[model samples]
Target: MTDAAAPPGEPEAAVTDGPVTERATCLLAPNPSMMTLEGTNTWVLAEPGAREVVVVDPGPLHEEHLARVAATATAGGRTVALTLLTHGHPDHAEGAERFAELTGSVVRARDAALCRGAEPLVAGELLLVDGLRLSVVPAAGHTADSVALLLPADRALLSGDTVLGRGTTVVDHPDGDLGDYLDTLRRLRATVIDDAVRVVLPGHGPVLRDPAGAIDFYLVHRAKRLAQVESAVEAGHRTPAEVVAHVYADVDRALWPVAERSVRAQLEYLTEHGLI
Candidate 1:
């Protein structure tokens, strides 16, 4: 789910399929597209010298990718004790069940239907797995079920699709609410400051070193887009398609369809708040 391009000066590290931090390693999935920047990031997280590990967002249902993630998580006598999904997007959670089966781990997600062998994730839930502390932070609006994991020990955030490494994410209207998304961003900005978060281990693209700055950019970008959408609507761009053509003209045509979802979300927000 792509949207507006990332703002300038947002730091992006060169992402590869390897260890990103002392407690986290990334396994880039095989699936890559305009929607998924590089690919869905299958993150393997564990404490140093710990025998148990946690895997997050097991990418697509591709057999090879799942196998790789399972292998990476279980390497050197480590056991994959838990599987967590950021959301139910196929690109992020489709392979979770198979991954759990492979590692004998239980899968947990905000959505009950997506959970396997475990209860759904709750906001503010602290998961203590093998000395690793991960706090479940509700991050709805990328999808209603999206949840971000905060690895406090490392001062890192496992930001599903709520925040991306290289570009803005789609609100994906109806299921995604712009109002909720805006609120989420504001909350995340505060979290970044209060927690002193150092890095964002995103689901796509690369790791973000400036969590606060990136979030601020997202907020500013959203405000700008909302203004553009409002202007487009007032300019007699009656339909979403017309609005997309007008407001997202700088974006790729192929991505207009995806951008339309966010435009609709923006329109809904505008209407609800009497800003349109």
Candidate 2:
């Protein structure tokens, strides 16, 4: 096992946010760190012929950034009419209400508490914004209420933290369930295969042109990590921290806390599966 799971030789996403499909433009946030590789990505979606656009993930509560997102959408005489959140993570949804106020749009999210002046997003819900259809898919890995958007028109997927553009996403323990995370990845993989989704617009990092490859990488990485954890446990690493020290020895110490959270989720999953 390696300290970092290699990204299948896929191109690393650019540090700056960039355009994805024809209709989606990513507005990168100012915040960047180990967890938030580049920063939160605020995606603005619009049809070429429409005046109304839809903004996804308003990012953090930075006033200037919020204003920038509004301005970007309103460029070329287009206006933002709807705001959607992939999840309730602060980096992704913290500025939603402010962005809604800026664009005079309603904010919608899977978590009811995250919704403002709009109904919670439902799984399988069909949304028609600017003459484009966005099919909501329940993701719920990084968080219990996480979701990813499927744009059939462009064959693009707006995946939140569930499927990032860079490294493997953490199954955030307590709130993040490893079992459900695996299910979500499997489901997304099936969508990539059956629907032929070509592009992945992640919540962070650069846009992925190879959706299938990214999904396959995530699924494989998760499986390999689970096997390593099982092996570590069978080798007498009974605690999550002990397992982390053994299985993630090569990983940076600063990330051990985050790794422990995922390790806990993995332990729970193994226990449930009777693998330890």
* RMSD in Å for all candidates: 1.1, 1.9
lDDT of 1 at 193: 92
Model 2 lDDT tens row, 105-193: 88899999998888999999999986978999999877899999998889989998988777778888899999998899888888888
Local error of candidate 2 at 250, Å?
1.9
lDDT, model 1, position 59: 88
Q: Relative to the true structure, how large is the alpha-carbon lDDT of every model? A: 0.90, 0.85
- Give one digit per residue, the lDDT tens place, for model 1 in 8-115: 455555566899899999999989899998899989999999999999999899999999988899999899999999999999999988888899999999999999
Poorest 10 consecutive residues of model 2 by lDDT? Answer: 1-10
Off by over 4 Å in 1: 1-3, 8-10
Query: Which pairs of residues collide in model 2?
Result: none
Once fitted onto the true fold, the runs of candidate 2 whose alpha carbons sit more than 4 angstroms away are 1-3, 12-18
Candidate with maximal TM-score: 1
